[model samples]
Every structure is written in C-alpha cells, then in structure tokens.
Target chain A: METRTQDTASFEVTPWEVRGKVDYRKLAEHFGVKLITESELEQIRKLAGGELHYLLRRGFFFAHRGLDSILQRIEKGQRWALYTGRGPSADLHLGHILPWMFAKWLCDRFGVELFFEMTDDEKFLVRDLPLEEANKYAYDNALTLIAIGFKPEQLHLIIDTEDIKYLYRIAIRVAKCLTLSTVKHTFGFTDSTNVGAVFFPTLQIAVAFLPTELYREETPVLIPAGIDQDPYFRLARDVADRLGYPKPCTIYCKFVPALTGEEKMSSSRPETAIYILDDDKTVKKKIMNALTGGQPTKELQRKLGGNPDVCVVYRYFQAYVDDDSLVSKIYNDCKSGNLICGECKLILYEHIVRLLQELRERREKAKDVLEYYRISTKFR
Target chain B: METRTQDTASFEVTPWEVRGKVDYRKLAEHFGVKLITESELEQIRKLAGGELHYLLRRGFFFAHRGLDSILQRIEKGQRWALYTGRGPSADLHLGHILPWMFAKWLCDRFGVELFFEMTDDEKFLVRDLPLEEANKYAYDNALTLIAIGFKPEQLHLIIDTEDIKYLYRIAIRVAKCLTLSTVKHTFGFTDSTNVGAVFFPTLQIAVAFLPTELYREETPVLIPAGIDQDPYFRLARDVADRLGYPKPCTIYCKFVPALTGEEKMSSSRPETAIYILDDDKTVKKKIMNALTGGQPTKELQRKLGGNPDVCVVYRYFQAYVDDDSLVSKIYNDCKSGNLICGECKLILYEHIVRLLQELRERREKAKDVLEYYRISTKFR
Candidate 1:
C-alpha cells in the first residue's frame, strides 16, 4: 500500500536536524523535500529584484516543491494563495517562523491570499484540553502570530470551537476522499488513540486548501512549513492533486535550534529555545549556558579562537540575523582567530532579545487581528 | 482503563433494531433508550382530556432528562428552543415522523423555538455523496417532512454545505470533546473503517446541540426517534453532560412494520413495506400478498377464519385507523370466524391508498424546497 511505503520512507529518510547541526544538502534529498536548484535560487533572487538577502537560506528554509512554478506564476503576474497553519500546542516558538516567514514572502511577492489555521480544536481532541482552555490558547497563539507582521488583509484565521457544522462538512468530505490505511500510516497511530485522530488528517489537508473548498473557484495553495512536517504537506499535496486541484508547493524550512541544539528549537525544553516573553536576564543566561564549539578556558579560546561555523551562537546568527554579509565576515574572522565564541554568542543573544521584544510591542498594536484573519476569503 | 470499560459498555448496551418483528422493549432497555410506562400513558390520556386521537400517544415519550424542566420553564414563560434533524439518505419515509411529531408536540405545548438540521453534509461525508446530490436529497427530504404539516414560521432548517465558516467552527469543537475510542465503539468499528467513521459520532452529537455551542447558552432538547437509535442518543447524552449542558431526553417510538408481517418495514424491500408513493393497484397487490394468519381452504377457514392479532393488516388498523371501536369490531369478527383475511386487507389497503394519492400529489408541488435551507444567524 502507498501508506506502508510512506511509513518505510519516513523511517529511512527525515534526518531530523537533531542538535541543530544539519548538513543542508543531505537533508534536502533525504526527505524528498524539493529544494531550489542553483538556477532556481538565481531565478528567485531575480524575482525578488535582487532581494535574496531577505531569505533564511542555511537557516530553516531548506526545501521546496514546485516552488519554481509559483515563481513563474508571480513573474507572469498571476496571483497565488498562501496557506500555512500552526497546531497551537502551548506557546509559540522561534521555530514557528519557518513557515510564517516563507508565507509572508509569497504574500509580498505574488500578492497571495493567505489562510492561517489555528488548529485549536485538533489540539484539544488530540491533547484532551478543556474547551475554554483550548480556546484561550488559540486566542493567545493568534495574537503572537499577528505580531509577526503577516499582512492582515491577506489572512484568514479560524479557531475550531467558534462553529461546528463547518468542521463536520469539511471532515466528512475529507474522510470520503481518503481511507483509514492512509491516515493510520500518516499519523503512526496504534490501536489505542481515538477515531478522531484517524479522521483528522483530512481536516489538515482541507485547511491547507480551505479557501478552495469555500468558493466556486478552486485555488492552488503554497504551504510553507518546517522540514519536520514535510510528510504532512506531502499528504496534503497528494489529496490536492487527487481532488482535481493543483498540488500545493511546500517550502520545507529547517528547524531553529535550541541552546542544546537537539534537532529543534522548542519552548517545551527550556534550555534549547528562548520564549518571546523571556526577560533579558533569562535570555542572557540561556545563551551563556548554551552548548558551543569554543574551547573551555579563555586563554585556550584566545589561542584557538572558535569554530564559529560549528558554534550554537553562530547557528543562531545564521537563522535570525538580518545581516548575511556580517555573519559571513564573522565566520571568516573566527576561523582566523580574530573572533571569540563568547563575544559572537553575546551578539547573537542581543539580536534575538531585541527581536522578541520588538515583536511583542508590535503584537500589542495589531488592530483587530481576528478581522484581519478573515480577509483571505475575498480571493476565494 | 476507563476508555476500555466505556468501549465495552457501549458494545454490551447498544442494540440496532431488526425489521419484521423486533423485541423492541428489551432492545430499548439494552441500549438505555427511554420508553413510556403504562402509568405515564394513562396520565397523557387524562391530560389530553380524551383528545388522544390527535396526538401520538403521550405515554410513548419517556427517558427525558430536561423535558419536564424545560416544560416548567416554558410554563413560567421562560424562552426555550426545540431541536430536531433528518438524515437526507433517501425520500423521507413514514418512519421519520417520530422526531417531527415530537418536535410539534414540544412546540405546541411550550411555545418554544424549533430548529431542524438537514444532515445532507453529514450524509455526504459518511455516505460519499456528491455535493449537488447531497443538497438535492436534503431538498427532497425537507419537502416530505414539511408536508407532515410543520409550520414554516416555527421551523428553521440548516444544510451544512452552505455557509461553511460559522458551521465548521461548531463541528470541530464537538470533534475535540470526543475521542476515537468513543466514536469507534459507538459505530462498531474494530480496526475497520477510517478515522472519518470515528469522527462521525461527534458530528451527530454536534447536531444534537448546535445552538448551545454557537450561542454559549445551554438548550434543552427532546430527540424523538425510532428506538433503534437509542445508542447514538446515549452517546450524545454523555457528551452533553460532560460539556456542562443538558443531556437530551429521548421519546423513541417503535418502528411500523411492513405489510408482510415482517419485524420491520424496509422501503428498499418493496414487498416488506408500503411506500408513500405507492399507487392504488400497487398498494392493493402489496396488501393482498401481505402475510396473514388464516386457513388456506374454505372447510379449514370455517374452523379458523383468521387471527387478526398476528396479521399485518390488523397492526395497520392499530396504527392508522381513527376509530378504535371499528378496530375492535374487525378483530372480534375475525376471531369469531366472520371477517376473512382477504376482506380485512382490502379495507386497510383502501385507507392507505387514499392517503398516498393525496400525499404524493402535494409532494409533486413541493418545488424548490431547498430555498428554505438558510444559514442566517437571526431567527426572524
């Protein structure tokens, strides 16, 4: 069965950037995540009018699928829609930017209509959360997302508890198009979890193309997400093509690393990643205690400086820093013993601390974020 | 451990009714369905002031959790609502009247709001129905239900395929409260069917109380149904109670049997049941072929003319005939070797044929029934 093959392939491939030190080239092919070729990157750069500097290359934006076609559409003045979502687990993480940023990029370049899903209902079902608590979490998550500077007029956000009939209709149609074997294989569920878990994949696939389902005109979507979730989007792509809609292209960005560099930058593990609400002291401590490639003693570090390319601090710079030229300069200077790990780490920490604070302030003033979320329906 | 016990309880308690001749009383108890007591029936008759001929027996309505409370509140002139639904599976069968009749009783008695869910979308997902076909069935089913004499002003119908956003918000929330274990156990799925199948129970529960989920106000509902569906209501009861809302009471009536003296009547099996659309000649042929308890020859017939108690035609008299005195006369004459099976069957056949002709003619004029299905939030 196709399901079994995906399971076999998921195991064999998907080398999680565990410890956050991933070989970008190897990861691209391992997950079957489409990546821009040398020419494709050049084309993307040209499409941006030499604005390649805004990208997160060597950071999290690692893979692509049919990304070139979307670019071609943009070049031809044809619009595309942006589709992406968050699970609304507990809190938002820097790793969450992997998809949102790419979605933002598509929106800016192609004037794509964006649909953002706050899968709070799904989180509650799978996580056994109380409805009130789940709803609150969804609201909080939405606020944080709005802070990220996604264009309000192009977005559509939904929470599961707000209405129910829509879910049933979408769920049934989704369930009909797919099968048990497909979902069981995709989610890797045992005989224990509920049937809701099995039937949930269709909702995800539906959310990825919800705009199309809502209107007479079908629109193809571009789903931007992290490499960890490549399988889900791949399933979405499969459902899309099968449903007589064009498959959604994926930009499978790499995950942001934590202080421990344990393949992901998760808030769940406090040591690996910093939260948006973290104070300056906590942020500094995390970065100071973070695992690094610098030699133990300062004297030894002065003699052997640091392998900046291998350091966690440098890794953060590659992901969050806006200045690519400065990062490249730091990398070269550190290799020649001109830059120290502690100093480079401090610089990275300062950038992240500033970014999170600025984001929080911006979120506070985001006008009628919920209204903004509903704006995507116009295109549909 | 709790999940396992609940699943086992569901399997042991739920019972689907069989056609021809079901042990309905025992089946109702096994599934935890409510049934009226003889004492209750006596009270209903007394309350009716001997006008029992107009209403379905009041005693048949039992297992109410909030009906009495809702009624008392209504008497105090507190606002309340009535909820009911129809599965758009096929033409509305005579069996579907259990819920409508109950809803009519509630509205007339309490002056409450009435809402009807055209479960076309639910059918689409579970039955793999096309969207247009699903809508068509809803329209067809609605007209038949309306012809039963539901007032236009007192009823509100919802077809899920229309106005997706608000409805989806409600369905997914209910989906979150449910688990696959509950859904699978309810549906009798054991490592069979998809997650969509598991997810379906939640949708039914969602429909059972869409108002409260949408408005954040608890609403009491009485779901009138064939006793066969008690298990589903039992599931709904649990969900409603857990959600801090009132569990719906059930007023389940027994199914009407086919003319063949089978346990249950099935429209698909034409020989087993009389359909609403059956013409005069077809109705006559079906009645003549109907199973009877009479002697084959004249010599034997003189000894045993008929046992009307075991005859399908006699049961029809018990269900449809307006005059109880006439019913008793027919039974007495048959037992006393006066009324033969052929003559008794003809009388019943004539009554049903007349009704069918009038019903079918009206059904033909119920054009554009879909116009009544609206997604408006306002009651007026």
Candidate 2:
C-alpha cells in the first residue's frame, strides 16, 4: 500500500506531486539520469550557432538521459523531433511553459517538428475535472503554446481525447508491453488508483513514437520536460527497444520555485503560482508580494545584505531575464546590500507584464489559427 | 496471486478462461444470478408473438439479471437494444456464435438495434497476436456476424481500436469510477497483467452505456452473452446508475459443450470446436468423431439406448434444432434404444452442414457490405 519510498528522503517528486526542498543532484542520481555537462552545453551552444537559451545558460534544464545520442544524430543531420506535453489540469503557469520554451528553441535550432500533447484524458482520469472541462483546457493550453511562438507547420498539437483514434492503437501497443507492476512502481499506483490513471502512461509513451507512425519512418524523439515526468519516459525508454521504437531521449528542467518559495509551482494552491491568464494587476501584485530573502526591516536589509541563493525573486530573474550580466549585477547588488527587495520586485514585475502583454496579443491571434496546429492523421 | 476462489467449487469461470465440469445451478447461485422462471419464459414467448428462440426454449440461456425490468420496458414499448461481442482472438466457433444468434432473434422480435463489438484491442493485449492480426480477425468476425443474419441497419459493429474515438471518452468516464481493486476482484488481474488488459473492462462498460450517448436517451441494453462475461456487466451494472446510464440487463447462456465433451468449447483447441468457416468435409469429420453417450458396441448401444443428457451431439441438437417435438423424439428414440449414436450424429451433422452451407454463402455476400455495419460517429 505504501506506493512510494521517498518518505525518508528530504524531498519527494512524482508525476502528480512535488514536496519539500529538492536536492537536484541527489534526485537526478536517484532517477538514474546524468547531470548535463559543460561540454554538452558547449556542443549545444555551437549547434545553436554560438547562442544558448537562458534556460540552458542558467543551468535550469540540468539533467538528461540520451542528450549525447540526440546531439550526435543532430550533428549528422539525421531527422528527430521534439516531444513534450501538459496535463491540462489547470491553466498554464510560468513553470508549465519552461520546457515548452526550451522545446521551441530546440525546434528552431534544429529545424525539427515538435509534438506537443495536451493529455486531457489523463487530466480527466487523475483529477476530479470533467472530460469536457479537461478538453476545454486542452484547447486553451494549445493557444498558449502557439502564443509562445511555435510555428503551425512545425508543431503538432495532440489533444488526447480529441485525437484518441490515432493515439489509442499506439497506446495499446505500448500498453501491451507495460505491466501493472511497472506502472505501480514508477507512478506509485496502488489498488485504489483508478485503472484509467494506471493505464495513462501509455498514452504519454505513445506520443514519443507517434512521429514514426505518422511519417512512416523510425523517427527519433527528444523530450524536454520537468524532472517529475522522468518516470513516464523512463518506462517509455525501457520498452522502446522491445516495441521497435527508437528510445525517446529526455532533458529535464528543475521546478520553477513558487512565489511563496515552495520547491514547485502548484495549481492546487492558486496563490503560489501566476497563471498565464492572470490580469496585469494580478501579476504585479503576485510579483510584488513574492517571497524574498531580504531582512525584515529596511534598515536591517541595508546593513545586512539579502540572500539571493534562497530568494524566489532571484530565481524568477534567472528563469526570465536573458541578459547574463544583468542577472549577475542584480545578484551582486542584492548580496552587497546595494539593491533593495522592492526595486528587484518592481523590475521582475515589469519584465513579466511586458512578456505577458506580448503573449496575450499572440494568444489572441493563436485562436484564429488553432486548427492549423492540430495533429491530423489518416487513422481518423 | 491466486486470482480465483472457484477451485473448490468444481469449475472455474472468468472472462478469460472456463475450466472443469461446470455445475450451472451452483455457478448461477455463486454468481448471484437468478434462473429464468417459467412464467418469465412464457412472457418472453408472448412478447415474441407466441414463440421463443431455441436457445431460450431449450434452457440454454438459463440465468438472467434485471430481466423483469427489461420485460416491463418491452411491455411498455420503451426503446431498448441488444448488446453482444466477440474477442476476435481466433475464428468464430459455433460456441462463439451462440449469444449472437440469440441476439439476432431478440433484435428481430423486438425490432431493436444490436450493438456487436469486436474487442480487437483486447485480443492484441491479452494474446501474442500482432495488432494487425487482431484487427484482421475483427473484420473477419464482423463478416460472420452479418452472415448470422444481423441486418446492417440494425447492427452497429464496433471494432475497438477503430471506434475508440467515440468510446474513449465514455470509457474514461467509467474508468474514473473503477479502481484497480474492483477490476482485480472482477477479472483476476494481478500486478503482472498488462495495463491494457486491466483497463479493457472500461471499454466494455462503455459499450453497455454507448446507446445512451448515441441516441441521446437512456436506452436500456440487454446483453445476451456467455456466463463467463457476467463479471464485466456485473461491474457495469454496479457503476451504471452512478454514470446516469441504465443498468444493462443480461441473459446468460450455459457454454456450448465442445465436440470432445468439455464443458466449454475453446478456440485454442481447434479440433474440439467447429469454426464458422469450416468446410462441409471438415465439419462432417469433426461431428463423426465427437464424444457421445453410447455403449462400447453397436449391439450394446441398441440394447441399452444412448444417453442424450450426456451426449455432445444431442447438446448441439438442443441448440440448433427449432422443432421441440423433433428434439423430444430424438431424446425419446435414443433413450428407448431405437436410435444409435452414429445415426444421431449424422442427423446433427446434416443440420449443421445445411446451416453452415447457407452461412458460407451469406458470409461471402457479407464481405461486400462489411462497411455498412460499422459504427460511425461525429467524433471521428
């Protein structure tokens, strides 16, 4: 009945839950993934024509399973695709879009297709949300992905329930190779777990192999996702060879620290995360009231410097701010008592408002072209 | 790990397996089902305008759940449909067609639709057959169902993987209400079972509720299936009210005894069962060698009469023979030491050969209209 063994560990991470302050190094080791190395990063930077996405530069997307093989295939000009997804349980947050942003960069740099899945069926199965509500969120999430600037031709949006005719066959193929024991071990499933939830990982695994069936070729897939999702792809990778599919490669990013300073942004606690649809006033308020490591009083903060290492505001700047020197200056200024928490909060507020404004405009246009980005297959 | 508790009960019956000499009375009692009363049979005969299918008249369909309500609905002229299916793991044997034959009668008598599902996905998951093979068999089985005389307009053929788009949403809804514990207890699922196999019951449950969605009304479903399939509908009935669908009614038939005199005819032992497509020569040979309740020699057989109660050939006659007096005459003649085993087998053989010969011609014609019977929905 005890489905997980992470109780003794300082932090727990699963596809459904993240708790406590996580140690990324130990977590990677426990998950059997290697930390991204400097050489690989340099190779990626060269592949991207001497520029790196801030996510990689800031070391946020820090672990991987088959990055070397993916890189090798890319270097040889062999075709591959970027695969990632969302659960559509709630509105997208900055944390939810982190991997998609990296996936977009991978798509642009490598000129490969991207399979973005909205697992509406999974959300419906695992949560109390109705199927219609989950499906509505799936389309809503697709708009946001389009707002993030993925090209219609390059992106294939797979909403699980809507496209299940195409997905079910592949999912069953993968499902036939998967045992309940493996799912229970990986996702911490118990007898009380709904069979739909236990069977859902196969749908996720199927997306990794979708392109192969779609294109009539053995296409390689690279998945950039939150570290919590490693278990699904790990199981996918385990069964890939047996199913005659290329093992999907993965690059995992650390969780985005919540405004309340939790290890991850959670949809359950609305105040801890800033949703993409949050109005300007809400965004400004959330950012200004965010947790920081500054002293309690202004005079005390000027005498004793703030700790950027533990500050949620600094984490946001690292994730959103593309300028390396600017981030460094802010960090140094805060650590040296030269910058106040209020000023840092205001700067982050401005950056987020500007980013969201652009996204809102693009999101409106995304609605008009939503059909173009949807996956089409002969199966239907 | 011991998935069944029927070991001490003389026979075992699950959705996937049937073993030993099944005691129908004990099995019905153990499964918490009721035997069809004489009054109920008379009501059904009246409903069919003073006649009943041979299967019902001869007590082959010996048990039921919710029959009174179904009869009441029929009396009130409320809309209802017949539901039955095949797993399509192999060629359709005579045993496989028993329920469908009963279903066809119900459809004709009531002028109601029939929903025939070929669970191709389940076959692939539970068997070593490839997906294509299962799908091929699904189409093949569909042809036979048509040959059995189900009108294309009245029959909705649901091939699992093909019609999954329509079924998936409903399946997940049912699945969300189903826990692994329920499936395990119902179907003998263990940790080593493929997750696809574990989740398959929901698809079946979805089919029972499908007409409610298709017609936008809470239509009652009457499933004519082998007793082994009772567990699925039992689980379906348990969840139906919660899902706002009518609790599907079931009429359970005792298994068709194999030629070798096993309690159930299994497709795995090809020689023990006559497939729908078996040639006249093969059918004759199988029937000639079939197990019968005859004495060691013809002289002894003539002296002591054949035992019709224990004869496999007589079981087939009881199923296929429509004339009650003729069947009674065969029984009386055999018991009175007038009819020999070979003569009785030849009579049964001639009936089957004529039946199969007409079926083969109809089956060839069924190929031309296979697409007409397939279920279509706006979901695709």
Best by lDDT: 2
Candidate 1 chain A has its poorest 10 consecutive residues by lDDT at A1-10
| Tens-place lDDT digits, model 2, residues B1-380 | 22342856478888778899998898888788899999999999999999989998889999999999999999999988888888886668888888888888888898999988899998888876889999999998888889989888789989999898778989999999999988888787789999999999899889999988888887989999988888888889989999889999999999999999999887888889998888889999999999998887889988998898999998999988788888999999998889998898899999998988888889899999888888873223
lDDT (CA) per prediction: 0.64, 0.88
Root-mean-square deviation of candidate 2: 2.4
Q: What is the number of residue pairs that collide in model 2?
A: 0
lDDT of 1 at B245: 64
The runs of at least 3 residues in candidate 2 whose Cα sits more than 4 Å from the true structure, single-residue gaps closed, are A1-9, A296-305, A335-338, A377-380, B1-9, B377-380
lDDT of 2 by residue, A1-380 (tens): 22232645588888878999898998888888999999999999999899999999889999999999999998898888889999885668888888888888888888988998899988888877888999999988888899989888889889998888778999999999888988888787899999999999999999999988888887879999988888888888988999899999999999999999999988988789988989999998898889999989777788998999999999999998788998999999999898899999999899888888888899999999999898864233
**Pick by TM-score: which candidate is best?**
2
Worst 10 residues of 2 chain A by lDDT: A1-10
Over B57-121, each residue of candidate 1 has an lDDT whose tens digit, in order, gives 42333444334555455446554566667668564555566567556655565455566777676
Model 1, residue A268: distance off in Å is 1.8
Model 2 scores a TM of 0.95
- Label model 2 with its docking quality class: high
For every model in order, the fraction of real contacts preserved is 0.49, 0.98
lDDT of 2 at A35: 99
